[model samples]
Target: MIHQSFLDLDYCARVSGCETCRTFRRAFILEQITGRDVEFLTNPDLQSPVYAVLRIESSGDRLLLTSTPTQKPSFAATVALNHEPRHLANDPTKSGARLTTDFQELRRVVRDCHDNHECSSRYRWSRRNPTWLLEIMDNNQVRLVRGPKSLVDYVVLSYSWGDPAEMPAAEWARIKGAGTKTRNGIPVPERLNPFSAWDLPETMRDAIDITKELGFGYLWVDNVCIPKGTNWDTEASLMHEVYGNAAFTLVASSSSKATDRMIKERLAWSHRSKAVKLRGKWLHNTQMPLDKIRLESPVARRSWTLQEERLSPRVLYWTEQRWYWSCPESQVAELEELGHVRPENKSMERRSPQLFLELCRTGDIEQLHEEWLDIVEAYTPRDLVEPRDRFLAIAGLAVRFYSAKSEAGGSFISEEYLAGLWRDNFARHLAWSVAKGANSRHNLQHIAPSWSWASLPLRMETKTKHAFKPSEHFRFISVVEEKEDSEKAMTGPNFTSHDSLSRGRTMEERGRGVKVVDVEGRFRRFVSDNAKQVSWDAIEWRRGKRVGFDFGAFPGHDLFARHEADGRIIAKDAHSGEIVGQLDYVVPDEALKSPFTPYVPCGGEKEIMCLELGESAMLLLVRNPSWGHQESYRRVGVAISYENRKGFFYGCETRTVRLA
Candidate 1:
């Protein structure tokens, strides 16, 4: 009979070579079960503990036994001895026997029998697909088995254990050792691909030896040599590498020069459009007080907050080539992706005739020597020509040369864009001269040549005294410098004011056949006999105020409005104080002996001429004008000073009038 604990290693070790194994052997034989049983083995010399194994019979009934005796070998002490002799009569360890023991040991015996059969070499079909090829015993390790050859590849057992994929590709290659990939016989160096544009400057240096010598490494211009077919995404990704990496950019200012010539040709092909019709257009009067006209409306300066291309001309150099009047960097990236190369080597690039004419006078004579000869050949000096004329003529040529390039398919930058770029770049210069206040604005006039206008009339010589002057038709607004040195301060006003009360007019051309009407009331305003209102007294000009006048007496009368005949009027602020000063407008006629003659007096007459003016668009002091004391006008309401000599008086000139 078999014991319930027959397969237990410790229990088997106590029984294998002892009387229990002999008893089990006899019992299994009596039952005639398949297989022989094996005894347990122990290494006595190695001092290793014991484990059990089985010896199978010819029919495969396995006999489990221990090599050592349990409790020093006593047949009567065996677990099977407790069963009665009758239990042994049926051979209880066997399923068909009448004698019975626990089912647990019996099931193990059956399972082991099946396992031995399946793993047996004679069962060759099992080799077709092995089951225990890989074994994950637990989280600590994995065991890969190939039958009896159980090999465990422990990743943690090796030194190189962390994630290798996270390492840089270059580092990976280095660790892997350098090797060349052969296409046919040609060997290509193995490398982790880098962005192409990052290497553009280096490529250019290798290609153009001359550029490499000219400090081109810092600002390489590749547009001339690099094909525009490169992918844009790659180019855009390399923007910081291209622009930020470079010291400065080279711009090709001549692209539009050729284009301008083409434009002229196109204009020639098409009929000319009619000139725009504008009324009441006349030259500004020199006799008009600067303080009065100082408040006149001016055309707005150009706006460039979000300009994509430079309005003014700027150059960028790269790749031994030059990109003239280049578009903004943001736009350039898009173009670069389109495969258009930027230009470079601008110091040697071809100059358009117009650009040569314009910028030729800007540099030193020695630096401009090459262009000097060309200028001398193109234009001859006129009689009594000012130095400015000579400079302008040379500058004109340069401008035309550059402009013509733009007219072609070149990247012609807009003049406005160029101007704005120059201004932003030279903002420090502006900050430097903000002092001298309004007079400092005059300093900006020299840079005016940068703003080239195609519509301005050009002539070789002027027949009139003012012939050499800027266009009289277009009033070039400038700040009139006041005696107050407030402009010298660092934080002084960026603007200037011409005070009518502090100065008076002095001009030789105050025409006769004109009558002046002082429109100074609680709201001080000024108007002429046949002209509109010109000046507004900030204090006197208020909402719901009116000044009426008569114009029927004058003949061939064209009213010269000083402030408001045709323009709209609206009170800018509320009125609350005593009417100390007034703003007035008048309709003056040329028939009057002198336009300066005042039609209103402060103390002499209670019926003073008052022409109510508009405050809708009047240019006022950058700061609110606060004349300390509120009092009656001394001589004439307030004197309109002519101040500077330019030309004719209009709706916004200053005039002197008596204040009561």
Candidate 2:
């Protein structure tokens, strides 16, 4: 008879010998389960804890004890004790035995993702195979194979490398030496077996084991498969194809770094099968559910993983608590019964390019804009080793979105990509504001133009209620690359401006040629044409203080108010006092006459531009608080006039002026 005692601290203490031995054994067990070393355990400041339940499985003839620190100690004990095994008489017809418990759920999830037509049909697999795959042999030896033509399946690993400072010099040397044979122009395959399996990062070892268990002949890990240096740029660009074409992507979600293990500490009894006689047949029961896992894991928070998660047709996300399966057709946990769906699954279903085409058909451009903003907000906060990879990281999604637009008849979408912003809806899309309490980093290598949100390395928010009206009169003369000799256009690497008439000139030259004018001529003309008399009763202003106005006081005032930093405005709905929308004051071409006209305030350098909302007209004020301030400006306020204010600007004279 076999007996198991969970959370058996006394038994562990007895088996471990003295106090010193017990502590050492506990640390070693924790290190084995969590892939954390003694240093990580000693670091009190680390967020993840080291405590876990210890399970001891024993029989009359033999004693077996197993405990992995990945499982929470408290819950492990409760689950183990709650599902105690029931002894039954053995019968020849019914054998109480099954296959290995390791990765049972994983195998099922992978099989379902592959076999299900609804899920597998969505993945667009490429005919061309990767140049190399890290092959793990039966002996647990790992080697790089050059073009395995017979291999039709491979798994990709998505994980983080821990802080560089903590990485040992020996490990760094091993990583650098991984492909040294190929580095000297040799075509021979490089073998990684010289390095001990223990030396490999925890994540790498786990990924290798997972790949083998999943019946895959090959695995692709970025750090090992791709050589570092100049070749990295070209390889990095192919990320979309690499991840998108994989059989499935394995996400080490819970582990922030390679050393952190994905599996959680749990009792051995919890995994042990509980046999029961149901009617005439014996039944085996175990607890395995998707509910224990979390969607927002540390791995999900990474900037690079965003594309990997979206592009891959299938993903097996291993978190600290549970395992989750996410494919285009379904996203659920191991124990979640079929038919039970999560909202995230619905969101994932809508991720395809087909959904974007539907939006285009309905002319739901605002919803599309909102979706893009959501992506931007999620991507911006994640960490990126190279800040320049900002646009590149999300470029895959942009490509898909662009393709969707093409499929929906490109007339509705903008062909020009101004850095990260689209040209067709340029004005309204420019209404992005920096997240409050977030500061923009100055030395970002300036990969984008100042006007684009990508130029600022800060989280951004977009306005909801307020819209930037499209102006047919306004023309995008041209956008030039800031770098003189470089061939890469200012428009993202994946995009090119279709307009040949728009010349690629220097920024200074661009500024010198463009101009803006106010068609209303003067404030008196704007007032006379719009209304019988100027409504001074509702208008109020302070001489020197920060500008303030009541939206309620000015009845016909079209300009909506919002906080400049986060673009959040107090909602008009009296029931819910919620703030919404992101607003940024845009300064139009200097060639255009000021929309403020004769009402231009004194003391500061004031610039005015037409604030176009969807079928609405308003005015925006950008003021340099002090004289001689070249770059700094504050968005003072906004004002709206009654009726279609476009009539006032009809036959407006055009002027050539520069815009900053």
Candidate 3:
């Protein structure tokens, strides 16, 4: 590309003719800033490639800029100008951030987020301090800050733990020792007499150095402060507070592991254009897109970091591409203009910090669970290092959720946490199953109740998006008897219901938008039996009427209808060759639908039971419980009937069964 001055660039474009002006014109018009379109808006026609934006300056620089080309024009396209060039740093290595305009505007955006955004202030500063904080001293020696409040503001580091086996023996020993020493408690401001930035991991070293440069006295790098093998019981539970209260979080996104550097490398981006020298000054372009900021980096894929980013008041990230600041309102990329983004393009999950407060204020339980399902959709798919961490990894986020739901002097919902799910929404919450194309596995340790998603290294799907249908399928089963759960818990025994069962007595009831009672591990999924096979002991049929087919639900997980309605496997009764129920697989594999004989390893054909969730949705519970939990049952799959079967679920086996 030829270098052209800012003013002359438009002239050359007009003289040479325009290529994307039509698209740019339509996009610019959407901004509603200018009434008419112009022949030459700027020297380079930077049509939006991802989301659209047209820059119009607010300062003395009455200049206009453009974005790369996009698929089609958008309603959100806006006319805006890039901020001062000071925000884009000439040297990333020296600045330790992306889009480092020497951090001139960076500080302002940070201040605006901290001082102005209430969502940021309310949840943040709630935790007085983390168990320990590393104080950067004038001599460059890092001192530990623990107990009580010595510092009001500090930065927290969110990075990857990486593969410990790859680390050196000596360094690994130090990391393990750090956890043990801290657990027993350490002296105040214990100066690690020999500790220096050089003695730390590359990511930690950069974080500490950058914290110093940012003029903060303390930085909380987990590897050094908390370390590997530390009993999370002490620090893990305080995650929401630790990250939330911090002045800001410094994310080492580019660094894959502790050994990787956080200074970042930009040599790969040199080939592309970013700036052109005009009158001995660089007229820079806003190149970073909104989607590129949070969704792409490797750190975003880690389970703990997802909660870290969601809980933090403000996050300052150093990805391989650029540095950006994310808060409740919007994300500010260093090189781009302030908030050069289309609000619609921002990820809702990323807005969790602010959304958390708003959800709590509304005091609505259903909406909160929906938000949780959204979190599960995103969080469960990401990788987990320790299978048991399914709950702990999200413990911080769960705390916020529990606190939000339980805000008004506690509720039946908040106090009851069975595995990773809330008791009140257990029915609707049970609509998750392994998403298609996801190679998920059940944990050998059963770290979670078999009824919870936490039991597996989750990659799940739910019926809300797919929308389960109950009317079209259920054949109507009768509950032979009704009795209090006689199986006494070591103490009090109670009833937990599907989020949809409040008005389930009527045939017209679609199981949504109803009052809920706290329940957990009451039911699970149903499995289909190809033959006229029926677990006679599992089902108590009403006099002349046969119980309908519940051939789809299986144990250990849940799934959706719309998500995978492509097709289903036909489940038939083994004895009569009767078409009973159908099993919906997450993926529409031809083989699955071809012969819907979903076998229960080493066991013969069997039928399952269903618990009504909403009008159309019923959780399928295989009558068989695992590992001799005879009085209890495990979940399998969820069943949705398109046709109304309000009467179908009536006359069902009403017994006090436990979910083990």
Predicted model with the maximum lDDT: 3
RMSD of model 3, in Å? 13.3
lDDT of 1 by residue, 176-262 (tens): 332223344332222112122212222222222222222222122323211234332223222222222222222211111101100
Query: In model 2, which runs have C-alpha deviations exceeding 4 angstroms?
Result: 1-102, 147-151, 165-182, 185-199, 267-295, 338-370, 407-414, 441-445, 458-477, 482-660
Candidate of highest TM-score:
3
Looking at model 1, residue 253 earns an lDDT score of 17
In order, candidate lDDTs are 0.22, 0.46, 0.50
* Model 3 lDDT tens row, 1-660: 122222343333345433233223323322221111121233245322333333344542322423333433322332223333433344342433233235565667777776677755455536477776777877667766563565478899987766566778776655444431433344423344436666666777778877777767888877567644466654665687788788888887666666667664342232222233343433433344544445655576678887787777677877654567866666777645445222665454434344554565567676677777767776765676676566667766676666665454343342344456655556566666543322222342246544555554454433334453322222222111123422222123222322211111110111111111223222322334333333422232345665443434332222111212422222332232222233322232333332222222213224455555555565555444343533444454444543533344444453344444
Q: Each prediction's TM-score against the native?
A: 0.17, 0.58, 0.63
Off by over 4 Å in 3: 1-101, 125-127, 147-151, 164-191, 227-231, 268-292, 337-353, 409-415, 437-445, 458-599, 602-605, 625-629, 640-656
Q: Give the distance in Å from residue 423's predicted Cα in candidate 1 to where it truly belongs.
A: 17
Write the number of the candidate with greater TM-score, choosing between 1 and 2: 2
Which portions of model 1 miss their true places by more than 4 Å?
1-660
Better of 1 and 2 by lDDT: 2
lDDT of 2: 0.46
Alpha-carbon RMSD to native, per candidate: 42.8, 12.8, 13.3
